[model samples]
Target: MAYMSGNPSNVSFVGAFLNTLGDRLFSAFNVAVEANGRMARVEALQALSDEQLAAKGLRREDIARHVFSDIFDV
Candidate 1:
């Protein structure tokens, strides 16, 4: 008679599932944080006058694009 052990396989499956879940949760968190940061940046830039913005080398029209360029690859 032969006995088969299933403990190792079960543990491996649980570990893989947990790892994937953790990765997805982390990715979602990062996306939320990035969006919040981008919105804040846009608002702050919008509060600046044209002269002040130009002093910082930024244009009002490009605020959103500038803030989100990292994610958009633009």
Candidate 2:
């Protein structure tokens, strides 16, 4: 009689489960870091006075546009 080897189905299920879990965790982490960085930028800009903003050739009205523009634009 031939002996049965490990179950390939179970192996595939475990691999898929781990891959999905890792993807979710990584996505959550990326979102959190992006939010934190955006908040930091807002805080830094808020801390600047009108004169300081002017010296940098920026205005308060331009803050959002400046922060959210594409990386290639910057």
Candidate 3:
């Protein structure tokens, strides 16, 4: 029934709270990077001409669908 700040057995509520906040921030950062990458893909696809798009079996309207195909059934 003893508590010490430096003791490994004693975990502070503040420390746990900060760790949870850090985890959420890191997760949000990762999601942002992923979204930016997807945006880059969209831009790259948009730069392609109709002929180029057809070569890949995609149309200009299908860019977003192609980019997020793995995540959505659309």
Candidate 4:
């Protein structure tokens, strides 16, 4: 009997692993961007005065909640 060496199972395993790894990498990338964006929003809001906040319809009390929403709404 001759030896046969091609394995479809190995190909499928490798493809699945690559796909999972790609998804994890993409998720991590998105999380990092979201965190950075939230930080920027917080900074921007903190830089504004109480009068400026009222003018823009954003209360000082809602800064944290609104900044988090602005980043994660995507």
Q: Could you give candidate 3's per-residue lDDT for residues 1-74 as a string of tens digits? A: 96565755445676888899999999999989999999999999999999999999999999999999987898
Task: Give each model's whole-structure lDDT.
Answer: 0.89, 0.85, 0.92, 0.88
* lDDT tens digits by residue: candidate 1, 1-74: 98867788898999999999999999999989888987898999999999999998888898877888877876
- What's the lDDT of the predicted structure labeled candidate 4? 0.88
Residue 73 lDDT in candidate 1? 77
lDDT order of candidates, top first: 3, 1, 4, 2
Q: Write the per-residue lDDT of candidate 4 for residues 1-74, one digit (tens) a residue.
A: 98757798998899999999999999999999988988898899989999999998999888887877754563
Model 2, range 11-65, lDDT digits (tens) per residue?
A: 8999999999999999999989987897789779878998998998889888766
User: Could you list the CA RMSD of all candidates, in the order they appear?
Assistant: 3.5, 3.7, 3.9, 3.7
Off by over 4 Å in 2: 1-7, 71-74
Off by over 4 Å in 1: 1-7
**TM-score-based ranking, best first?**
3, 4, 1, 2
For candidate 3, give the lDDT.
Answer: 0.92
